[model samples]
Target: MNNSYFWLRCRCNEDIVLLKDPKSDNRSRGKAFIYPKERSYKTFEIKYSNKLSTKAKFILSSFNNKYIYYAIDDLLYLLKSNPTEKENLLTVLYSSILALHNNLEINFFDIWIDNIYINEIGKNNRFFKVEEQSQTLTHITLTLFYRTRSPFKKPEAQW
Candidate 1:
């Protein structure tokens, strides 16, 4: 509940163009930002509200601007070079999932690939022992936002 976001200015052709920051500090000033694909803003906010909890919203807020593709490429390189550093990201995912099904007794469907989003939350160069098989530039942080659509269906099955 203590998260913030930036709203989209307008939908560019096949690209997300960030518009402005929320003008007010009101709790519900605007819809949470998302890396939407083939979906309307209303559909993502209303239809997928179930997964928009605090833990998940934190991740959604990370994609408040462009240049995310480049950051992701860097993140992937870091992970590939050092797989052991995946614990932090996995912990966030686990908490988000727990919050997703909090106080619920419903049939949870499998995660759809389209609904999952990952955004980089910048990076910090901290002290870490240089491992022989690891890259020295493993520092980009990340946030995870997994959307929930009703009757979730795997991409392969839709074909």
Candidate 2:
């Protein structure tokens, strides 16, 4: 199984990019691991379902206009320097986790500094509501690649 990954920055939105694998086909012999072909790439936008709460949207919106991307380590460094943001940051993180779990049934095993990003807002250290501050500290855009089957689930017919 050979899978290729690419990061694409859209001309219209520099802050958001698509981390894509052009050869993802479930019908292929090796799903999500097929060789690339000359077919046109299919692009899709990820939108949260209506199941997501208004509060969640409000929390995420606070991250708007922040930096295009920030690594987990960079956020950690920032938190270290400004300890006051710690509580807000954690709240955002937990909210994000719960939202994904409940809304999509997607469990993110790789939740680390390397896999996360913090927006560039609030760099000037301006004060905001706790909820808004949390969003500013924990807003992230992620592109995940995974198999259809749940890795954590037990096989129906165990060998």
lDDT, candidate 2, residue 26? 52
| lDDT at 114, model 2 | 16
Point out where model 2 deviates above 4 Å: 1-73, 110-148, 151-159
lDDT of 2 by residue, 1-159 (tens): 236555556777564655557567455565432322331111112322123234433444444322212332344554554454544454445565455456556444422211223343432335655555433222345322222333576559755
- Per-residue lDDT of candidate 1, residues 51-137 (tens digit): 223443344334344333433443345445334433344344344434445633212232221233433232334575444323322
Deviation (Å) of 9 in candidate 2: 51
Cα RMSD of all models vs. native, in order, equals 19.5, 18.0
Candidate 1 residue-pair clash tally = 0
- The local distance difference test score of model 1 is 0.37
Pairs of residues clashing in candidate 2: 66-120, 66-121, 67-120
Off by over 4 Å in 1: 1-84, 103-110, 116-159
